[model samples]
Target: MRDLAELDDRVTHCAACPRLVEWRERVAVEKRAAFRDETYWGRPVPGFGPPDAAIAIVGLAPAAHGANRTGRMFTGDRSGDVLYQALHDVGLASQPRSLRIGDGLSLRGTRITAPVRCAPPANKPTPGERDTCRPWLARELLLLRSTVRVVLVLGGFGWQAVLPVLGAAAWRVPSPRPKFGHAARATLPATDGGPDLHLLGCYHVSQQNTFTGRLTPAMLREVLEEAKHLAALA
Candidate 1:
């Protein structure tokens, strides 16, 4: 892809994984009861934010009723509620709520994306599906290689998924791959002699975590603050 826009267009058309393609489409047609009257953007969800983002937030996949319905990563969901609120509190987001696309929500110098663009059944994508979707994330990181300096990965699935893509995008991922943990940090040196990239880990903003106090709004904001500092946007 020549740019993020082109990449995004291609991503939306992707049907590389049969299982994912079927599931996302089926959910779109069936329609959740609360959203029956609304149109579901059953197509693959693309990353959101500017092309030259200084920081990137990576998540596992589109939620079946969230991004799948809104066609924007992390939108229209409880997880998005917590995540965006934290971003707003840290001054990275223009608003605390991401109800849907065109809701006037904006990220200052951050972009949000996912490893799996399609919503998987039960919110779990198989290993094959994750690998099948790797090229898209790899291409996205490559496109943002010039500007993005910090990657805030939510949960272990995204952490694992992004590390390989980072390597492919010219960052030298460390040997004995870094383990995922809330607040974990790793610095990856650019193989092509570019600026070093900082990787920050945070617990996902899923309801399970937020409701159980496993991930608090304060904790999420702290990570965003750290990302801003690392990206020099603070």
Candidate 2:
């Protein structure tokens, strides 16, 4: 929901969390020589999708082999394969194949962002890291002007990080609580509108989650359907 200029700036020189910066730098240096000439953004990578999207998809963070390598959120990762397909199936995206930067695909009515803009060491960011990244997200969301009708938090961590921004903070609790599932739906009052912008939850489409049968194409489609159903009124 961030303006393109603000989003672009964040992607260019973000330094909200120290741990992420260190890890991303390490990957940029220690990984294959193929990435040597490819300079790492070494900062918070902004969400990749439409600028005025109505559906906002939130991921945990960038991935070592994924966004860190390709400079685009969810790119070059197995997780993106399933997610992109689900988007296509739900009419939010063009048919998606690969996660490469050259994929030339874009979400039609959806935008994607992360709780932690930078890739964490093992994709697990500490609480402080998540907290530190919230302001920028707040700026983006507040600036979005309620155009976003549904926010899909891709996992438990993602859900927690998002609720506070939506002012569900008083009711939502901390970790080891709710598990991300196919039916997860949190209807939140819209920040601008007095009505709502539903927030659907899901197990991350990571290799671990998908391979473990925790998430599937059919399951993801159902959640997207919920968004579509809710957005139809708006």
Please give the TM-score that candidate 1 achieves against the real structure.
Answer: 0.98
lDDT of 1 at 68: 97
Name the lDDT value of residue 9 in candidate 1: 95
Best by lDDT: 1
Clashing residue pairs, backbone N/CA/C < 3 A, model 2: none
Per-model TM-score on C-alpha atoms: 0.98, 0.86
Which stretch of 10 consecutive residues in model 1 shows the poorest summed lDDT? 164-173
Model 1 lDDT per residue over 47-116, tens place? 9999999999999999999999999999999999888888999998999899888889989999999999
**RMSD list, candidates in order:** 0.7, 3.5
Error of 2 at 50 (Å): 1.8
lDDT of 2 by residue, 1-234 (tens): 337666657554877677788898888777756566665545567777766767778889888867877777877678988888888888877766545555678777777788788889878999999988887666666655446677788887887788777664213233444445567766654444444666678788888889988787898888888877776722
- Model 2: C-alpha RMSD to truth? 3.5
Question: Which candidate's TM-score is highest?
Answer: 1
